[model samples]
Target: MAERLLIGALKSGKNTKIVTLNGKKMTKMPSTLGKLPRLKTLDLQNNLIPKVCPEISALTQLTVLNLGNNLLEEVPEEMKYLTSLKTLHLFGNRICRIAPGACDGLQNLILLNLNNNQLTELPQEVNRLKSLTCLNINYNQLTSIPRELCFLEDLSELHLNYNQLICIPEEIKFLKKLQKLFLVRNNIEVLPEGICDLKKLRILDIAGNIIQIFPPRFQDLKLREFYCEENPLILMQPFAAKHQENIWSLKEITSRFVLNQLAEENPFLMNAIEHYPEVRSIISGGKNCAICGKFFLTVWLECVQFVPPSKNWKISKNLQLVPLRILLCSYKCFNQRDPNLFGISQE
Candidate 1:
């Protein structure tokens, strides 16, 4: 029936630039499609097309192709020859794999949607889409993102939600032009620190993960909206509690403890301890000394003693002394202390 309709359309004019056979119950694309040399847009969505017809590649002038909601097992490599193609939609398909060179000559492509597919990984040739501005691969079985994806310098929005990703690659910082990033509902345990370098980023959604800490400089970013709900995040609790919203601005995080706690838990700081032993020593020793009121970098001692009763105090049957502890930085400071003056005797 689809072939008959196309034959009728071709009989009217051989210079047809658009063909719409959507929902025509097409089990296979008719070879007669190759006869339209001036065709520019082809819509075969909601059809039963099991595979792409190799003859379709003869339509070099085709710019928009929609084969969504089909039974295609893979993307045809010959389709890459459609150099004038600008938009390709393969969503809602049974596609399990994309051949490596399947997108080699698609230099003019701008948008590619592969959402709701059975794909586990993207082809390396995807990086060759230098003109691509938006990519949607959500609701797939992707375990990881390819590093080559960061090479899409013009990409502004990326959707990877509802996947099995364990961690975001640090190379994501390379997406300098990225404005929005969607990574919700993954098994990600930690957010990569390099994400803080996205100067143009405005929205970041990492909800439903096991994130415990943010990047040390996360508060310094110019993000307009942030979402981290349903995660076991400890440092972001105060902000979330005060805002009472799933998405909030970074300016609302006014607590000093947030930065302090992040610095203590930062993996980069821990890694730096290996190269700077003195910094490790100071962090391990103590905070400050009671005698000199200076930071400690070496030995320190803590002394606990109970307060003694004074002459002005009234005698009570159930009185108890409270204990106080003092930190001494060095042995010399401890030796010079006057225990008797503090109401304690030293043997």
Candidate 2:
């Protein structure tokens, strides 16, 4: 029956650019599909196909392929030939792995769906899909994703919900065009401060995680939507009597001294940065205290300030208080902090 359908579809015309073979119980792809060289879209979803025939590679002009809800255990190696593909759906499959280089030729792929699969990790080669704008791999077994994915500068949306991820790399800040990010139901404890660098991020769903507070300047993001329910969020407490002396290690003191000199463009330190990349790296790691405006390395007092979202922002109704982190260079700086900023009780 499947063969006859393919034959009839072929007879429809040589210019047939679309074919839908959904719900077909075919165990394998009909070699007849190779005949439609000019086909731009093929829907083989809701099928029992356990594997794809090499004949699939002949459809070089294909732009969209849907192979979801199938019995496939891995991404077909033949996919590399679909160079013109813009959207590929392999969701709801048993796929646990993707053969290396299977995505090498999909340069124009804009959207990819691998949700509800068994993918434990994504291939580093996925960075090769330079044009990918949206990638969905939700409901997978991924414990971590390749930081190389952060290099996909054009990616606008990323979904990693229902995974076992403990933390995302700070490199995620490189996704400058990212708008919506969903990391629901993961094991994330603390979000990276770099996440605040994504200037275009507008919607974020981090519900069902164990996050305790937002990173500093988190409220600065012009988010239109935010979901952070079900987490053990730390609440701002009434003013408490907390006093601790600021103790700086010798390394911290020396690094701060060097950083100050570098800021003043000291000839020796400035020249060292030119010849010693490690020295440049250490200088780059310097962070300014929120209160004192002085550079500090490693040792700083952490505090939190509650910020309410602006009227235009849409956040969870239960989320009344947003904790914005603050780093102070010393106890004196902490004491001079704004009245609204509260120190986290170490009790």
lDDT by residue (161-205, candidate 2, tens digit) is 999999998999999999999999999998998899999999999
Tell me the TM-score of model 2.
0.94
> What C-alpha lDDT do the candidate models reach, one value each?
0.73, 0.89
Cα RMSD (Å) between model 2 and the true structure? 1.7
After superposing candidate 1 on the true structure, give the runs of residues whose Cα lies further than 4 Å from its correct spot: 235-347
TM-score of candidate 1 relative to the true fold: 0.68
> 123-199 in candidate 1: lDDT tens per residue?
77788998888898888999888888888999999989998899888888999999989898989987776788999
Clashes of each: 0, 0
Best model per lDDT: 2
Return the TM-score for each candidate structure: 0.68, 0.94
